[model samples]
Structures are given as structure tokens and as C-alpha cells.
Target: MTGKIVVITGAGGGLGRALSRRLASDGDTVVMLGRTLSKLEEVATGIGERAVPIACEITSPDSVRAAFAQIAETFGQIDALINNAGLFQPSTLLEASDELITDAVMTNLAGTAFCARAAIPLLKRGGHIINVTSESVAIPLPFLTIYQASKAGVENFTQMLNLELYDRGIRVSTVRAGTMVGEGMSAKIEPETMMRMFADAGKRGIDMMARGASSYESTVDAFRLILNSPADLYVPSVAFHGLPAGWTDAG
Candidate 1:
């Protein structure tokens, strides 16, 4: 209420946790939203009073509405909403189960839409929405058809949402991020699946072992920048990629 109030989804996860900490340190009141209360609280505890943990199952419309209602009551308005919650699993399209496809689409794509719809009423003029997408949508990777498709949908949603919100003075933007590593970051794919994905990527000229990854901490500042940009500056989207291992500047 006193400072900028920001809501970050998936705040229990690595990148989300990092962003929560970084934004709180910048004096914003960060609401950490995720499905797991314990995880959100763990991250919030480290940030002290500036951080608030709220359990939210983004894939559920009722859950999302309830969470935002709570947020509206507590803070009245939010300066920014960071759509960072997502699910990622490696499995061939043909082999992927129905649950996997449903979870992937609902969590990554529909969840984002649900949160945005709920947040619209609470976001005033000059409010910002930062939707996190992945570089995997553009870069080829095996066993990620669902993940890639969902994130691609997010990218498109960001663009169209920006147009819809333009008249309202609420800025919508997308952050297309590359591979990142951070504390508590883990992918729940079987070892064999991972091996197959790696081997397949290698055959396609992409080396997982040699690929570079950014620290989750390194990307948090970019969101801060987006939130603090001048009112006249409208950035529709921004992308970030890590340098490959042993890559050097020649010039």
C-alpha cells in the first residue's frame, strides 16, 4: 500500500523466488502467489515484511478469482502483475499422456489468462503486466511440444492483450527468457527421457551440456526495469539469451 504493490505468480519457484526477493529489496510490496503455501512462505520469510505469501492455484478460475479478491481487499490496487507460473515436462507428443497436455496448457496458457482477467480490475492507469515466456518456443527442442506450444500461445496473448489494454494505459509486455539455472530449480522428467531429449537435440546441433544458462538472479533486474520504465516508454516485448560456453568477443 505504501510502496508499489506487485504480484508475482509461481513465487515458490526459482525464478519467481528470485524476482520476489529482488523486487522486495527495491521497496515494492511483493505478493508471492503459488500453489504451495509452504514454498511461498519460505521465500516470503526471507524477504521479511515486504513479502506476502498467498496460495493460488492459477489453473483454477475460482482459485484465481479468490486470490485476486483477497489481493484487492488487502492492497486495493496492484502496480504490476508478473505471470511467471508454468509447468514443463519432457515427453514425446505421441507418448505424452492426456493429463500432461491438459496440465501444460491449463497451467502455462490458461492460467496466465485467468490471472490477467482477474487482475484487470485491480490494475489502475500505468499498471504493468509482464508475462514470462521461454526461448524454447523459437529454438528447437525435443520432447517439449506441449511446453513450447503453451509458451508460444503466451507470447501471442501478450501482444493482443497489450492492444486491448492500450486505451486503458495499462502496459502489457512479454519477457522471452532463455535457459536459466537457480536454486530449487528442477525439471521432473525421467532420466531416460532427458537422455533422449539431449541426444536428439545434439543430433539437431543443439548441445544441452555445452549450452550456457543464466542465473535466475541475473534476470530479476530486467523485470524491475520494465516496471520502472517511463510512462511514455512502451516496450511490447524483450528477450534474453545466455552466451554459449567459451564464447568470446572477437571485436
Candidate 2:
């Protein structure tokens, strides 16, 4: 993966920041795309010369197009794209507001599609696209109907993109991760709130072991695997830690 130009959406924070550092350290030129330029610059500073910050709003096509054009001009070409920008807001099917549902869909599903559309032309043969979705798509949890549906859309979109790009020698893969434990999680909500969400998730038979149990390192390893693998290799649709029944581990 040396010298390969990779574009990571939402590279400013959380999993995206971790992956940006990992890839940049491995000698890949990573373009950090996010809504906030300052945050992206913060991550880019840590990554040094290998990382470039590009402010982008994933939900807006104009924003994606402009960002990719800048990337093409600066880097000449893109070897891979990681559609990692996503939003998760818990909303039950019956109680979900239209705005909440729309926002989730726009960020998680439409955002990935918009980026992929802009990236395909820049990606030559043997390039790859990795969509960072969630395990919740498979094991739907309570109070997250909209979030689940948005990720489910990403999974389906990635599968179809893979088949569509097969003839062109481009591969598409997805990393459906479980609950990733990192600064992002801790920063988003307090411990008590997390406990309540976990308890509610448990009652829905959503498999807590697989739902909220992943370190940033583990998720980055999954990304590295996709990047280093051959074009024909396709990893599973989801990845997460396992907790046995009656197990109690929550902080």
C-alpha cells in the first residue's frame, strides 16, 4: 500500500481519525475529508506530510464533488476511498421523526453513494472502496430503527457497487463494525446514558457482545486487512466482539 492515495471521509474524528493515522503511518497518502477543517487539520498534523485535509459535507453532492476535484488536482489520482462518514441517532420506528430519519439516511446512505459516484472516475483499475457500516444492520436493536435502516442501505449499496465495478477491476468491501470504544464514544455520551442504551439494547435481543465492543485498534486492523488484500478478496459483512449470555461488562 506504499504511496497509494486514499481518501477517507469523516477523517477528522473517531474511527476516521484512527484510520487516517494508521494508513498515513503505513506510507499511504491519506486525504482527510470531514465537515470541519480544523478537526481534519488536527488529524493531518499528527499524520504529517502523508495526510491532506479536505473539508467536505458528505450529505451534499456539491461538497463531495468540490473536495474530490481538489484531491484529484493535488494528488493526481485516488487509489482507494473509505466511506466512513456516518451518523447514528436512536429513533424507534413509531417515534422516529421525519427529520431524524432523513438526516440519518442522508449521512449514512446517501453520503456514501455521493462519494462513491464522485470517486469512481478517479479510481483506476485495482482500486478499492471500503464502506464503514455497522453490525447493527444485521442485528437490529431497539430505538435505532432509522440508524439500522441507513446502515442496511450502505451494505446493499456496497454489494451492488462491487458487482458493478467488477468488470472495471475495482473492488468494494464493507467493514460492519460493532460498538467501537474510543474517544468518540466517550465524548458523545456519558457513562450513565450508555448504560441505559445498553440495557435497552439487551432487552431487544440484539446481542450486546457483538453490538458495543470494539476498540479503535481492532477496527483499524480491519481496515488494513481490506487495503492490503487482493481485489478478489471480500471480507465478511460485519465484525465485532462477542460477549456470552449473562455476561456483564459495561463502563
Candidate 3:
């Protein structure tokens, strides 16, 4: 595991960037894939020779195929595929535009599947596929219906894929992540819409806007642990959440 070649989608920012850095620091070669070449390059430059930046629009199959091909040619084989690229557009169902809905499904569900399929042939036996999902799929945050639904589909897909790939010596697993903040974290909602969503979440006693979130850097350890698991041990899924800073059970 020390010198493994790992490919991560959305590696330009947020958790992907953090994971890429952490993995490389741990002695693995990291392929950073994202829609923006500049962004990916920025990260790769920081990681030096261990990092490979590739421009990839995960929502497009052709783009994904080409990026993976580049990865295959450069590295010859990959030890892991981290489906970490996603788009989170918050909007009420009534206010949601066609593009928002389409992007969410395409990027979160379709893109993940496409990457997994493309990586299948290149994956060595004992290779792992890690799919990142959201805690909101079960927590029911306001104005995230489409996002939640799409990720729910991914969770189910991960389960079925685990079974399907068992015979091939591949392992599929879900990392049901909680709220996380990092340098790449961003929100593009209009102020009015954001206010409405906050109000609605407050009405339900969730008050998500004020909730504490884990840092993206803090979550990288999970991926490291999963990738280094013993050969006989198979982790089907890992679910984690953030608590208020300094929070304790005694409180």
C-alpha cells in the first residue's frame, strides 16, 4: 500500500485535494482529476512528482474515458479509484431548474458509475473503489431533495457493485460522509433562497446553517484506513458525521 497508484476524481479541491495530499504524503502516487486543469495543476504542483493532474469533466463519459486512458498509459495500472467528485446545488423542488436536476444526477450518480466502469479493467486484484455519499440522504436537510436522492442511488449502487465485483477480486464500499468544510468549499445560492432554506431547516429543528462541520483534512484518515485494510477484512461501508467543535457526550 505504500507505493500504490490511486486515481481520485475532483482532486482539485476540498476533500479530494486533502485526500490527494494525504495519500501522497503516505507514499502513494495520486492522480488528480477534475474539470479545471488549472485547479488540478495548482494542487499537483504542490504535491510535486507524486501528483498527476488530469482535466476531466466527470459528467461526460468521453471525458472520463479519455482521462482514465491517460491514467492507464502513464501508470499502466491503478490500485484504487476514489469517486469524490460531486456537485451540490441546493434548491426547493418547485424552484429547481432542469439544469440543476440534470447536473446533480449526472455528476453524482452517472459520473460515479462511469468512472467505476472505466476503472474496472485497469484495477488490479484487491483494488478498492471508494464512493463518497452524504449524511443528508438520511438526515433530510431542507432544499437538498435532488442531492439526497442522487446520493441514495449511489449508496445502493455501491452495495450491488460490491457483490458484483466480489468474484473479480475488487471491493466496493461507501463512505457516508457528514458535513465538511475546506478551502474548496463554496455555496452559490442567492441570499433570498438561502434564507428560505435556513428558515425551513430551522422549522424542522435541524438548523443546518448553524451546524458545525468537520474539516476536509480531518476526513482523509478514513480513506487511508480503508485502502490499507487487511486482505481478509472487507469493509462494506463507513458512515461518519461531525459534532460541534469540542462537543462531548457528557454534554
Select the stronger candidate by lDDT from 1 and 2. Answer: 1
- Model 1, C-alpha of 23: deviation from truth (Å): 0.4
Q: lDDT score of model 3?
A: 0.91
Instruction: Give the whole-model CA lDDT for all candidates, comma-separated.
Output: 0.91, 0.82, 0.91
Clashes of each: 0, 0, 0
Candidate 1: tens digits of C-alpha lDDT, residues 1-251:
36689999999978998999888888899999999999889889889999999999999999999999999999889989999998988788999999999999999999999999999999989999999999998899888889999999999999999999999999999999988887978566778888999999999998888877888999887787799898999988888977775677634
lDDT of 3 by residue, 60-80 (tens): 999999999999898788999
Where does model 2 exceed 4 Å of error? 186-196, 206-212, 232-238, 242-251
Please give the range of 10 consecutive residues that has the lowest summed lDDT in model 3: 242-251
Q: On a 0 to 1 TM-score scale, where does candidate 1 land against the true structure?
A: 0.95
After superposing candidate 1, which stretches have Cα over 4 Å from the reference? Answer: 245-251
RMSD of each: 1.7, 3.6, 1.8
The CA lDDT at 190 in model 1 is 79
Tell me how candidate 1 scores on lDDT.
Answer: 0.91
Give the residue spans of candidate 3 off by over 4 A: 248-251
Inter-residue clash pairs, candidate 1: none
